[model samples]
Each structure stands twice: as C-alpha cells, then as structure tokens.
Target chain A: MAQRIDVKDLDIYYGDFLAVEGVTMTIEPRSVTAFIGPSGCGKSTFLRTLNRMHEVIPGTRVEGSVEMEGVDLYGPGVDPVAVRRQIGMVFQRPNPFPTMSIEENVLAGVKLVNKRISKSDAADLVESSLRGSNLWEEVKDRLDKPGAGLSGGQQQRLCIARAIAIKPQVLLMDEPCSALDPISTLAIEDLIAELKQDYTIVIVTHNMQQAARVSDRTAFFNIAGTGKPGKLIEMDDTSTMFSSPTEKATEDYISGRFG
Target chain B: MSTTAPPTGKARSRSASGRAGDRGMNRIFRLVSTWSGALILATLAAVAIFLVLEAWPAISLGGEELGEQISWFPEDTSIITFVGPLIFGTLLAAFLALILATPLAVGVALFISHYAPRRLAQALGYLVDLLAAIPSVVYGLWGILAFAPIVYPVWNGIAETLGWFPLFEGPAADPPRVMATVAVVLAVMILPIITAVCREVFLQTPKLHEEAALALGATRWELVKTAVLPFARSGIISGAMLGLGRALGETMAVLMILSPGFLYSFAIFQAGQQQTIAANIAAQQPEAPPLGVSALIATGLALFVITMAVNMAARAVVARRKDFSGAN
Candidate 1:
C-alpha cells in the first residue's frame, strides 16, 4: 500500500555544518516523484533523511520532521530500524549479498529480520517478487546460484526485488540506473513506471531527461556556491516544470545553460 | 609540425641499453625480485631436508639405542611412545586456545571495526595491536606467577564438583601448572593476532552492502550477521589458523605453565601429566645424548607438518564456497 509523505522545514546537518536547509514538500501516494539536481546539491542527502538512513553516518543530524501516514518517523521512542521496515531503498549501485543465492537474495528482507516462513510460502514469495521485478524467467532455473553471478542489470533488479519483498509502503531510489548501460537503464525506467502503480516512489537522478520522462512531480534542488547549503529551488508538475513556469535557476538547469 | 628528437632519442637509448651487454636496470630489477622469491622456497626446502636428515637416526633405531628415561626426555621409551603423547598435548593445548580465543577475538574485532565510537576506535585498535608486541616470556611469567594462582581455586572447585568429565578429572594441581593453564596463556598470546586480522577484514566490508542490510530494517547486530560476518568468514578462518599456528609453536609459555611429563592424560587440570612438542624440545634438548637429540628433532618435524596441514586445511575451507566468495 502506498503512503503519502509530508516533510516539513527539514534541515539536514553533518555535525555543525548544514548540508540542506529549509526544505518543505508533500509527496503524493501512488505516484513517481523525482529529485533532479547537480553534484553536492543535497537531493540525495534529503532522500536519505526520509528513511533516517543518513543517521547511519556519524555526526549527521536532522531537524524538523518527516511524517508518513500521520506518524512522525523521527518521533521520540521511534526506532530507526522500525521506520526503515516501512520504507525501503535502492542505491546507485546494485548490492545483492554476495553470499546469498538468487532465491535467498529475493527473500533477504524477510529472512534478515528474523521472521520465519514455511517452505511453500518462501517459494511463493520468491517467485512473486522475482516476477514483480521481471527477473523470474531469467533466474527461475538458477535460483540456487549466487546472486553475484548475475549481470549488472539483473543484479540491480534483484536488489529491487529484495527491497519490495518486505512490502514497504514507500521506495526511495538514488540514481538506480546511473551505473547501468543504456538498454538496462530503459528496463529499469519501465519498471519504475510500473512500480508507481502500487508504491509511492521517490528517486534522485542527475539526468534531466530521466526526470522529465518518468516522474509525475519534479523537484529541483540548487546551491548558491561551493560551500553553501542546498535549497529546493522549485517543485511543480513535470510538464510545467519542463515547459513553462519555474524559477530562473531551474530554467537554466533544465536548458543545460549551467548547473 | 616540428620534430622533437629528444623524446625519441631517449626511448631509443633505453631500448639500446636493454640490448647492450649491460642488460639495463629493468633486467636487474626483475632478476633481484625473482631471486628474492626463489630464496624463500630454497630456505624452506633446506630446512625440511635438514629436519628429515637429522630425524633419520631416531626413526631407524626405534628402541634399539634406548637409554634410561630422563624426566623430560623419556629417552628410555621408543620414539613412537615418546612423541605420541607430545602430539596429543600440542593439539589439545593449541585447539583449546583456539576455542577459547576465537569468539572473544572476533567480538573485540567487531567492536573496534563497527561498534566503537569513531574517535575511541582508533585508540582501542592500537591498544589491542600493542598486546601482540609483548614478549612470549613475559606472558609465561604472568601465567605462572600471577594468573595461575588466581585461577587455582576455580580449577580445584571444578575438579571437586565436575570431576566426572575427563577434561577436569582428578585432584587439581595445587600450583595450577597444567595444560589448561598453558591453554589460557596461549589464548591470551594469540588474541591480538586474530583480532587484528579480523578487524582489518571487517573494516574492509563494502559500505554499499552494509547500507543495503540497514535499509532492509536490519538492526545493527542483524546487519553484522548478514553483511559483515559472511564477508569476513574466510578472513576469520585465516586469522584463527594463524593464531593456532602461534599457539602450537609457542614454547616458553607452555614450558613455564605446564609441568613437563610424557603421559597421555586427558585430565588437563592435573599437573605433571601432559607436555607439548615445542616445550618438550626446549626442556629436554639441552640434556639429551645424540639419539635423544634426534628424537627431539623428529618431534620438531612433526610440529612442522602439523602446522602445514593446518594451513592447508584453512585454505580448503576458504576455497570451498568459491561461488559465494566476496572476492567476486
């Protein structure tokens, strides 16, 4: 089930230095929202704070709130671990556990949380998740093979299957196709379009054309200078953001004049 | 375009030097490196030959040239009888040390690599590494004078209560100088080594994989179990085997803590019953006659073989899961 996310006045900091400041947005359920920005613009940093994955790095602190379905994710006594169970993530690179088989990699989210499943249920879940990622036919015969034996695109799909196996309400992808070939990138883009039908999706991409192609809502982030904190320049429907109304900086960035 | 002759001339001269009788610095570098690698193999082969040659007399004579049983030498017994108990004691003490130290070392390693605060972790790592720098003789003295007395009462209590177990059988040594004491000392001796290797491997685990586990709602312990431990399994095995090798060859600590005897007894709590090969060689070699010295050399050869076999076994274990190896 997809869930709406409300982020209010969130300031992300690494120690005393604020990396992202004064950001506010509401992400709609069952839709694709993309964050497009240049290097060091803090779009990825903001995405990490949504699931509190940024806290994994020492000295990182978040001010303000990220609420999902009316529950404050960072509320007192709320465990980050539990927050993550409801929100999954796919990284810039595919990272299936090298020690696990294809079937086990698909079942990693459920198995790693120490849940018990019957043999038949495990088999069913593996099949459904792999088919959901469009990887079932390619790997069904080799379920016992190591996940690392897959090609780059297949490995990335395997990671997606792993993330969704736990049935999270939201999925955050940070440049999921950045490391793939053009053909693999198209496969992932198509999969992303299909995934939005069932899960609220947030993606950060360096490719402007990618944001225009797949996202329903587009948010542009920008920085003033090398050492300045990043800020959200504008947020609008993808067509309007690309075609007409936007801040001057967003227009220049979209036109490829400068980052 | 202007022609630049200096760059081309320099290359020609370099190739010319290679073809000339001088053979150039590149050839010299290759020769030096090749010889360095060859020297290591040459030295190992030489040592093996020496051990086999020196141990021949003991092997050929058997019990024909037996003399009175020296307290430490047991020269009166046949070579088989003398060395059999020594092999058992060596394996028992080293493996006991491995069982005692491996988990503790791995925990300390994980704490330093993943659990400790960033600033404190560096200092903690340095302290653990410092433990390895201490001399084996110092550990021997510590085991004998300080630690043994402290644990003597516990040893006696275990023997009094759980003496039915073969390992704890009998009246515990009053001074607590026994194989168990030797094992404890050896465990401490090897702890730093295993911790250092394991910590290095744990630190080198891919950050991407760790984040993947965390994003799946895995707790810190769960992340370590799923991501860190499996990746470091081979490295842990290698580290433990390295520690076992040290424990097996450790002479000074075993000699000081284990009162020397040549009996095959499984009762590790008792004194004057068990003796390891290295310690036996160290204790009895000085007083032995020619044939007795050969017997001691044979035991040393056995120790060498056991260590090699252990290293081979470790490699096999590491290679068994080739498809799942993190090296990919």
Candidate 2:
C-alpha cells in the first residue's frame, strides 16, 4: 500500500556545506512526482533525503522533518535501516548485486529483514515479483543465471523487481533510466505508470520530456550559483509546469535557456 | 624546455623538444623492454642450471655419501641423510605461520579499510608499512631478547590449559624458542604484507555495490558481509600467499627464533628445538663439505618445489571461487 510524505523545511548538508535548503513539500500517495533540475542543483541529494539514505554518507545530515504517514523519518529512534526497508530505492545504474543470481537479486530486500519465508513462498514471491516487473516471462526459465548477464534495460527492470519485491510503501527512483537505452527507458516509464497505482513513486530526472511524460506533478529545483544551496523553484501539475511555469527560472530551464 | 617554433625537419629534431625527444626515448625504452622480458626467463633458467650443477654431487654420489639420512654433518659420518625433515620443518613452520596470521591480518585490514576514521586509518596504514620495514635480524634480536620473554607466560598458560593437545603437550620451557615461536614471529612479520594487500582490495569494493547493499536495509557489518568481503576474497587469499611465501623462504627470523633440533618432534610447545631448510642452509653452509653443500642445494631445490606448489594451490583457490566472488 502507498503512503503520503510530508516534508517540512528540510535542509540537506554534507558536513558544513549546505546542499539543499528549506525544501518543503507534500508528496501525495499513489502518484508519480518528478524532481527535475540541472547538475549540482541537488535533486538527487533531496531524493536521497526522502528515504533517509543521505545520512549514510559520513558527515552528511539533514535538518527538518520528513514524515511518512504522520511519523517523522528523521525523528529520534527512527532507524535508517527500518526507514530504508519501508521505503525502497532504485539507483541510477542498475546495480543488481554482482555476486548474486537474478532470482537472488529479486529476493535481496526481503532477505534483509532476516525473516525465514518458506521455500514455496519464496519461489512464489520471486515469480510474482518478476511478473510484476514484466520480466517473469522472459527470465522465468533462467532464474538461476547471474543478474549481470541481462541487457541494460532488462537489468533496470530487474532492479525494479528487486525494489518492488520488498513491497515498500514508497519507491524512490533516482535517474533510473539515464543509463538505459531509449527502448529500456520507455519500458521503465511504462512500468512507472503502472507502479504509481499501488506505490507512492518519486523520480529524479534531468530529462524534461521524461518529467512531462511520466510524472503527474513536476517539482523544478534550482541554485543561484556554485556555492549556493539548491531550492525548489516551483511545483505544479505536469501540464501546467511544462506549459505555463510561474517562476522565470522554471520556465527558462524548461525552455532550454539555462539550468 | 619551452620553444615557440614553426619549423622544418632539422629545426624540429634539434629544438628543445618534448615530442621529438620522446621518439628516441621510446626506441630506447622498446629495447630495454625487450631485454627485461627476456631476462625473466633467462634468470629462471640460469638459477635452475646452477642449482642442478651444484647439487650433482649429492644427487649422483650414491651409497652413504647421500640418500642415507637428512643430517648436515656429512663429512664426519659415513651415512648422510636425505632432506625429508628439513623439507617438513620448512613447510610446517610456514603453514603454522599462515594459520596464525590470517585472522589477525584480516582483522587489521578490515579495521583499516572499513571501521577506522580517515586519519586513524591513514596512520595505522603507515605504521603497518613501517612494521614491514624492520630488518629480519632486528626482528630476531627483538624476538629473543624482548618478545619471547614477554610471550612466555601466555605460551605457558596456553600449554597448561590446553596442553593435552599434541601441539601443546610438549615441555613449555621458559623463553620458548620452538617452531611455534618461529611461527608466531613469522606471523607478526608477515602481518603487514597481508594486511596492506587486503586493505587495498577492500577499499576497491565498488561504491555502487556498497550503496546497493546499504539501500537493501543492510547494516554496516552486513553491508561488509554481503559486498565488501565477497569482493575481497581473491585478494585476501593472494595476500595470504604472499605472506606465506615470505614465511616459507624466511632465513634469519626463523634461524634466531628456533633452537636446533634434528629430531621429528610433533609437539610445538618444546622450546630451543627446530631446524627449517633455510635456517639449516644459513647456519651450516660455511663449514660444510662439497657433498654437504650439494645436499643443501638439493634441499633448496625441494623448497623451490614446495613454494611453487603453494603458489599453484593459491591460484587454484582464486580461480575456484570466481563464480561467487564477483571478481570476473
């Protein structure tokens, strides 16, 4: 089941340096929200903060509250491991534990909880999750094969399968399609459209057309200069953000003027 | 040299030139490279030929001159001994060192690569490198004068508490200078070589793979278990082998730590009683007859075979684990 996120006055920092400042927004449940910005504007950094993964890096911390279903993720006693389990993430590159097989990768997240599911149930879980990712028919026979042997798009979908296997409340995708070919990118885009009906999905993309095509709502991020922290310039319905963005920066960025 | 020149061939060659000068240097490097490659096989062949020529007396001098016993004093006795015990001693001591060093080296490597803070890790790394630089004779002196005395109580305690075991069942003498001491000292000596290689390998675990593990809700240690360690297995084995190589061929350190014993005693706790091939050759080579020298060389040939076998086995381990290791 999907859950809504309420982030209030979030400031992301790597050591003493402010990366993204005062990013306050609510991401609705069962919808696709795209965070778009140029390089160094901290879109990916902000995305990582949502899942409490930003703090994994040494000396990196966040101020302000990221709430998932009324519970603050950064609040005291909230384990980052638990936060990650509840909210799954797919990285830019389709890194399917290079040591694992295709089936093992699908089982990776669930196995992290240290629960012992029955063999039949695990096989079923693998089948259903692979089916959900639209990869079961193609890979059902060779589940024992190494995951890295798959093509780029297939690997991305395998990653999606791996993430969704956890059945997280929210799925945070950070430029998941950038390294993929156009056809694979389209497959992921279509998969995202279907996935949003069940799970709250947030994606970070530099591709404006991708933001327009895949997201229900688009949040544009910007920075003043190199040393400045990135800020959310605007958030609007996908159509409106592309057609008539209120902020000059958002419009210019959308119009290919400047980052 | 900086020169602004738009020039003909003569001016181009004679100018203060990086590009033109590099061409002659490249040819020189090519010639040097050819010789370097050739020298490797040439050196191996030369060593093998020399060893064969020197050991011919022991190999051919049948009936009591050789092929009788493993004793070094060949001139005094009519029956000289084969090098079976010396071969056994060298391998056992090296193996003993390996088993002792592996866990400690891996722990130190893990601490440096994963656990320690950046500054502390750097400092520890430098200290370990310094540990590796201490001369063998210095280690021998320190082991006998300082280290052995310090370690006596602990060794005696282990011998008493677990003395029922064959390895510890022997006499636990004061300032124990047995094969076990040689092994323990070799472990300390090889620690840096193993740790340094493993630390580098652990650091080479891909950031993407590490992040992948973390994103899967793995704790720091679990991340290491799933990602860092599986990735580092080959390097660790190879590092262990490097340490093992040094332990096998070690002369001065083992020579000082172990006391002389000609018998095949299985007990490790007995002090002042062991002779590895290297220590035997180092100690007795000066006073030995031609047959004695040839016998030593033959023993050296056996050690050469043992080291080769150990290396081959290490290569096999690295190759065998490739599927699960993710190094391919």
Candidate 3:
C-alpha cells in the first residue's frame, strides 16, 4: 500500500559539504509529486535521501527525518537496505543488469534478495510488471535476449518493470526521461500517471513541461549561489504553482527568466 | 628538432597534415611496432622448430636403441612413455595450485577493490603486487625453509584424517619436499597475478550497474554477485588462465621444492613421487647423456602445447560469454 512521506527539516551532506539545507515537505500517498530545478540544485540529492540511496556514496550524511506511515525512516534502528526495499528508485539512465536476459532483468529485485519463486510465479510477475511499464508487447517475444540490446527507451521501461516488481510503497525516479526522445518521454509520462494510482511517485525533472503535464503537486528547488546549499523554494498544486506562484523566484524559474 | 622540419606554411597547407615531424614519427612507429609483433611470432616458431629438431633422436628411439645405451632414455621406455609421469605431475600440481589459489586470490581481490577502506585498499593492493615482484628463486627458498615447515603439520593431519582419499594417501614426505608442498608454493607464487587482474576488473565494474543493484535493496555481497561478478566474469577467467600458465611452466619453484621422481601416483605428500615436466627437464638435463637432453626437450615441447591448449580453452570460454557481458 502507498504511504505518505513527511520530511521534517531534512539536511543532506556529502562529507563536510552541505548539499541540501534544512527543508520540509509532505508527499501524499497515491499522487504524482514532481521536483523541478536546474542542474546541481540538490533536487536530485534530496530525492536520493528519500530512499537513503545517497548513502551509497562514502561520507554522505542525513539529518532530521524522512517519515513514512508515521515511522521515521532515518530512525536509529532502521536499516538502509530495508528502507530501500520499501522505497524503490529509478535513475536518469536505464540500468538493466547487462548480464541478465530481459525477463531476468525484470526479476532482479526479487532474485537479488535471494527469494525463491516457482517458474510459473516468476513468469507471471515478469509479465505483469512488464505490462505495467508498457514494455511487455515490445519485449515479450524476446524475453531471453540480453536487456542491454534494447533501445534506450525500452531499457528504461525495463528498469521501471524491475523497480515495480518488488511492489514498493513509494517510487523515486531521478530524471527518468531526461535521456529519452520526446515520444519516449511522453510514453513514460503516461506510465507515471497510471503508476500514481497504486504507488506514491516522486520525480525530479529539468523539463518544467513534464512536471506540469504529469504531476499533481510541484516542488521547485533553487540554489542561492555557487557553493551555497540548495533550498526548497516553493511547492503548490500543479496549476496554481504554474499560473500564480507566491515566490518571485519560483515564478521567474517557471517563466524561463532565471534559475 | 623544429629547425629540421619543413617551413610552417608548407606543413600547414598540406590537407592531411598534423605536423611534418609527427607524420614521419608515425611512420617509424608503425614500422617498429609491426616488426615487434612479427618478432614475437618468429621467436615462437623458432622455439617450436628447435624443439622438434633436437627432440627427433628421442622420438625415433626404440627399445633396442634404449638397450644399446646410446644415451639413457628412462632406461626401459621411449621418450613418449617417459613423459607420461612428467605430464601427469605437471597437470596435477598446476591443477591443485589453481584450486588452492583461485578462491583465495578472488577473495583478496574483492576485499581490495570493494571492501577495504580507501587508504588501506591502496596499501593492500601494493602489498599484493609486491608479492608478485618477489623472484621465483626467493619463493623457492621460502618454500623449503619457511612455508614447508609451516604446512608440515597440516599435511600430516590431512594424511591422518583424510588418508582414505587417494591424493592424501601418504606417509608424508620426510623433509616435505613433495608435490603437495610444491603445489602450495606455486599457489602462493601465482596468487598475486590473479589478484592483481581480478582487482583491476572488479574496480572497473560500471558505477551505474552497481547503483542499480544497491537501489534494488541488495546487500553488499548480493550487489557483488549481481553486478560486479557478472561484469568481471571474463576478466576473472583470463586472470586465472594467466596464473595457471605461470604455474604450469614455473621451473625454479618446482625444481627447488620438489624431489624429482618418475611415478604416476596421486599421493602428492610423498617425496620422490612426482615431478613436473619443466622441473623434470631441468633436473635431468645436467646429468643426462646427449639423447637424454633430447628426451627432456620433447617434454618441454609437451609443456608448451599444454599451455597453449589451456590458453585457447580460456579464450573460447571468454568469447562464448561475451554476448551477455555487455562488453561488446
């Protein structure tokens, strides 16, 4: 089941360098929330901290809290691995395990956890997940082929299938369509709209139009200057944020006047 | 150097030109590199020809010729039969060493490349490389003096506990200058070679793939299994093959550590029970008559063929898996 995420004064750091300053937001369950910002603005950094994926980099630290279903994800006893199991992530580039077949790539989340699934069960999950990502039709006939052989769009879709196969409560996508062509980007946007019905979705995008089209809520992040930590500027309903933002900076950013 | 070149205007006007000097240097480089590559094949062919020509007498020797005592060719057998025990010993010793070293080498490699802290990893990598730099003669000395005594009790324990197994069936060597000790020494000798290559490959695993595995809720070991190991599989095979090549042809360590013998027994802990082809050739060459030298060369040729076959097999394995590794 999808769960609401409540962030309370969260700060992110890479060693001694603070990357994202104190900020707060509540992400609703079963809704599309978009994070929009220019490069190095810490929108992606903040997104990574949600599932604790940023901790993969050495010396990265998180302060304050990210809570889901009233449980603090950054609580002392929480395992990052377990946190990740509940919150799946997709990266800017599609990475379907190069050594695996299309079907096996879709099953990577479960298989990597060492779960035992019957042949029929594995087939069903692969089929359903691929269909969910809208990749089943193009790939079903060649499920045994290597995943790396696919086009960029198909590979990204395959990665989406992999993430959803684990059935996480929330999904974080870091520029999922940034590397795709416009047609492929539209397909992913449609998939996002459908995915939000069952899973809480958080996306980071450079394309403002993408956020406007797919997201129910939009959060804009901005950096004050070089070497300054990025801060959350504003967040509001998609229509309201696009049309009449309370902050001058948010309006400037949306209107292409400044970042 | 600049003064020797053509005028700048002429040099620049030539459509395909970089610098006149560079074009000339490139031509020389191509010529030298081509010759260097050709030299390798020429030397290999020369070695093969020399072996066959010198080994001709031993190849043609019959039982009657052996009785004539033209030269000692294993007393009663021809060169083909004489090489049987040597071939067996070479394969067994190298096989045992590979078994002993590959997992340990891969473990140490994984630790250096992934598990160790940054500074410690660099230090450990250098330490392993330093081991490879130690000469085979020094390893031979260490094998007989330090390493052999250290493993003597363990060898005896194996003979006592697992003596029912053919490989362990032994009244262990008195001074322990045996095939089993020699195999251990060879394993240590080859460990750094495999570790160096494996560490390089493991370090080269794509960051994207590793992050994918990590984001999938994979543990450290699981990530290694799913991402790092698969990508490094071909590299590991090639590394192991290189180590095996060294073990197979290693003469100094085997000669100094193993007491030369002419038996086909699998009992490796017994002294004077086995001898590798290279070691046998080295050991018998000095004492043998002229024909005996020919017989040794024949065995050397055998070693060469075996090493070549092993390398070819490794290449085939690597090539077969190339499609799925995304290395293409």
Alpha-carbon runs more than 4 Å astray in model 1: B1-29, B68-76
DockQ of 2: 0.40
Per-residue C-alpha lDDT of model 3 across residues A15-69, encoded as one tens digit per residue: 9999999879999999999999878999999999999999988999989999998
Measured over the true interface residues after superposition, the C-alpha RMSD of each candidate is 6.6, 6.3, 6.3
- Angstrom error of the Cα, residue B251, model 2: value is 1.2
The candidate that wins on DockQ is 1
Worst 10 contiguous positions by lDDT, candidate 2 chain A: A108-117
Query: Which 10 successive residues of model 2 chain B have the least lDDT summed?
Result: B72-81
B223, model 1: CA deviation in Å?
A: 1.0
Q: Would you list the C-alpha lDDT of every candidate in the order shown?
A: 0.91, 0.86, 0.91
Candidate 2 residue lDDT tens string, B86-126: 77788789989899998899999999988999999999999
Q: Each candidate's DockQ score against the native complex? A: 0.49, 0.40, 0.44
- What's the TM-score of every candidate structure? 0.94, 0.90, 0.94
Fraction of true contacts retained by every candidate, in order, equals 0.80, 0.56, 0.70
**Candidate 2 Cα outliers beyond 4 Å, as residue runs:** A115-117, B1-31, B67-81, B263-265, B271-274, B323-328
